[model samples]
Target: MSNPDTSSGTLPSHEIIVIPPSGHQDRLLLLDQCIHVRIDVFVHEQQFSLDVEVDEHDPIATHFLLRLVPSLTPIGTIRAYRAEGEKYYKLSRLAVLKPYRKYHFGRDLVLALHRWVNEDAIRSGLQVARVVCHSQLPVKGFYAKYGYQPEGDEFDEDGAPHQKMVAYPS
Candidate 1:
């Protein structure tokens, strides 16, 4: 069952739930909300190119959202896509509203995604869950705290520094 707080309606102040993509309508809604919040933070606010942020893979990927109570406003989102020719999932596009940053919503979003991916993998008989975040120098440690390891030297994405990282279930 989907969390009532995050279902298709208004919620109260103390609750928020993550929803899974099940059908076309649900998937489209999740994509729009996720893209909106991510672009607002990564593109418009941070000056990252919009082209780099919105990608063709979004339409088919699994998406999730966190919403505010009473207002049903979207507060955060995360997504994962299957890497071609591989048995792993690539988690990406994690974002949360600026006002909610200090409350660990970002980490919560990640943990939620981790749960979703792990369950899906076990159900499908898959072996690993992998994620790559733009190695923002400061946040590399953050990802490390969650078990992601840097795979290579830093690279640039829309003029911002980044590095590839991966996570595996223990």
Candidate 2:
């Protein structure tokens, strides 16, 4: 899918690239930005337990970063990791900077991940792709709109109520 209009209402000179986990040095820098945003938002702002925010899995997980042109500053990030013994991909730690949230960057980041997963599945000859999301209870409907279904009862994570949800793409 095409990216949403993030051009400040005027044409933008910068281009947005989605870097996979295996990308090179520059890509690793972008991934770091994504992790930083998540830590800032979920760990600091929301007071989520610090332990819930960082983990050893990060180094091996797939990450996505949204970089602006010219300055090339990363403004948003999302991550995906293998789940259920590599049978599914769990998407987590999605965050966009406060100033850039108005541009629909979060949605764009998600769509980019979805596209990447689809492409990966095709190349690997897989029939379907799976993504799991841990969503705040009230916002579960937002994910539902994207075809995610609750997997089980609500659970508490980092002191906040969340529901486990899964999406299957054929």
Candidate 3:
């Protein structure tokens, strides 16, 4: 596998994009792509259970698809949704294919999600909104780059240790 750390940070702006639900593709198609990437990343690569991979939240969550430019092949995905009675938005299911990971598409994916959350909050007439993700132990630092901080003690989720990270992205 190529080293994501040593790869170049720059990519042609037109070559990669993170898209929300729209006429560019059917909603179901977009979601299906999201699930495929998650299965590849979380289930196959990380040994997460398939049963928990696609949960009830998927129906209500706003999903984003990351596609390669021109060909528009789906390579990564992410989602954000508000849980019942929760005051903040929950971001989850972020995944990028192994080869594509070296391109830093994951950063763009998370940024798009944060932009959506902030815009959604503004539309709802809210002054503040927090976005939280259950970050796996190894990538907790990845979330921290976007201002997310560990909020509590680490615990097990999906048979792996994780930390509940919170980010107040404006």
Name the best candidate (by lDDT). 3
Worst 10 residues of 2 by lDDT: 11-20
Give per-residue CA lDDT, model 2, range 73-109, as digits (tens).
7667887777535767787887876656656677777
Give the clash total for candidate 3.
0
lDDT of prediction 1: 0.73
Worst 10 residues of 1 by lDDT: 1-10
Pairs in clash, predicted candidate 2 = none
Which parts of model 3 are misplaced by more than 4 Å? 1-25
lDDT ranking from best to worst?
3, 2, 1
Q: Write the per-residue lDDT of candidate 3 for residues 22-134, one digit (tens) a residue.
A: 45556677678778889988999988899999999887888888876675667788899988777799999999888677567888889989998999888877778899999
Clashing pairs in 1: 11-70, 135-163
Better of 2 and 3 by lDDT: 3
What are the root-mean-square deviations of the candidates from the true structure over C-alphas?
6.1, 4.8, 3.5
Q: Candidates 2 and 3: which is better by TM-score?
A: 3
In terms of lDDT, model 3 sits at 0.82
What's the lDDT for all of these models?
0.73, 0.73, 0.82
Writing each residue's lDDT as its tens digit, candidate 1 over 33-128 gives 778999888887788888788887676677778876666778788877776666877878888776566566777778877887888788878866
TM-score of each: 0.82, 0.80, 0.86
